[model samples]
Target: MKGRESGMPEEDYWQSFFDADGVVETLFDAAGVAGDLVEFGCGYGTFTLPAARCTRGVVTALDIEPLMVARVRQKAEAQALHNVRAEIRDFVSQGTGLVSATQSHAMIFNLLHLEQPLALLREAHRTLHCGGTVAVMHWRSDVPTPRGPSLDIRPRPEQCQAWLYAVGFTDIRQVDVQAFSPYHFALLATR
Candidate 1:
């Protein structure tokens, strides 16, 4: 299941919507994440390359689109980031293709509005090692975002929290990420 339409913009235009480093710093720092990271959707390598550089562990970046996966791989190679492994995968339907309890952290940025958010969250939970963190960011439903799924389908902070809880994540809390991007909100949960 591909989930609802992402309403994503073109590559260059969508890349402009974020200051990749700033967003990555805020989310990763807030989560106190370390070690290997698994990203559910590596669109344009917006967060993947930066994350690979920031951590001592590998970044397994998965995307449903081959173009997106190839883009991430190109960025990683251009940046000389040997730790990033970009894969073309239908993670939404088939899961991350990573072993359970093998990753130290997971990044689910800008992807929580899927039709089966719980399925993805559970997959994240299963992949993460005990005590590992999952950092989630999504378009803020309260505000009119420049580019995101419509408010009708976007998951609010509260709704995201509930879904996280249902997936057996603990210590779930919202992070203040206004400085990173006004259009998005972040949550950190532990497995």
Candidate 2:
């Protein structure tokens, strides 16, 4: 963490992320956590904190960047959320294995636009129990943002659904919410 900057400008984008058309409502609906829930890119704990508040199990907020990890930790601490935790983890790990019996739900917003999401999705796949849920959403249309990565890698609803299907997730489909204008699709896949 030596050369790490104080904070990321990405945190500012979250100010509007929860305000997006139907995003916040969908997040609220994502309530009702049964067991351990994992958020892949839990930026600043916007969704993580709420999901934790709604659930009873541990919330593992994993991000690749150390700065992002620190940011989420700060947010969790500021809110006095005792069950949430954050860690720095690359999408791909060389070798390791451990999974618990408890089920876990997952949320991925504006995160599927990465250059390689499958590798991380595979890790997620390994960590979930049967009947676990995964929610993935990306920008509906490409909007230029210097602060964020290129969204050219985004997947359509159908594509996301198919990807989930290919990854062994059952009940894979899109959640039709009013939050999206042209409508950004969020694919829900059950483990």
Candidate 3:
């Protein structure tokens, strides 16, 4: 149950397209996220490392790609970040394997464009504690991005909000992340 291909460029090339610090900062700020966090599709540890450093609790990063998981684990180890748990997991099929009502926040970065977006959003809702946050980001449909899924499949912010609402999330608000990456937009939803 691996997600659809991200259509990303090489690691360095894809990483070069984003201001990682700015994106991570804006995401956490918009979500009011703290405590334990779960990140889905943490490719190349772009956001995972910063999140591990920022949170007092653990940051569990899950990816279907073993290479991606290993890269994140390597970065966490190099940084001596004991709070990170980078595991190769097909959460899309097996679920998060995290206890319900346990995680304070869930991150679905660059992944909502998958074939089963609602299913993933439902999983995010289930994993979070009451009043917990669900942060989602995708390539902005309005602009041409250096690399991302086709525009026909890329979700708009409003569509994401509607899906979150359908999954029992509330307080859904758009976060202005254009400063971080002009091609991306983000939203924060509460469960």
Candidate with top TM-score is: 3
Q: Compared with the true structure, what per-residue lDDT tens digits does model 1 show for residues 51-127?
A: 98789899999888888888888888888999999998888778988989999999988888788899999999999
The better-scoring model by lDDT among 2 and 3 is 3
In candidate 1, which residue ranges exceed 4 Å CA deviation? none
Best by lDDT: 3
User: What's the TM-score of every candidate structure?
Assistant: 0.96, 0.78, 0.96
Candidate 2 residue-wise lDDT, 8-111, digit = tens: 35556545544442553464365334777777766666677777776668888876778778977887788888888787765445311326434467777667
What are the RMSD figures for all models against the true structure? 1.2, 4.5, 1.1
Candidates by TM-score, descending order:
3, 1, 2
| Clash count for each candidate, listed in order shown | 0, 2, 0
lDDT of 1: 0.86
Candidate 2: clashing pairs of residues? 22-179, 131-191
Give the distance in Å from residue 160's predicted Cα in candidate 3 to where it truly belongs. Answer: 0.6
Clashing pairs in 1: none
lDDT of 2 at 189: 78
Model 3, span 14-95: residue lDDT tens: 8887788888888887777879999988989888988887788999999888898888888899999999999988887888
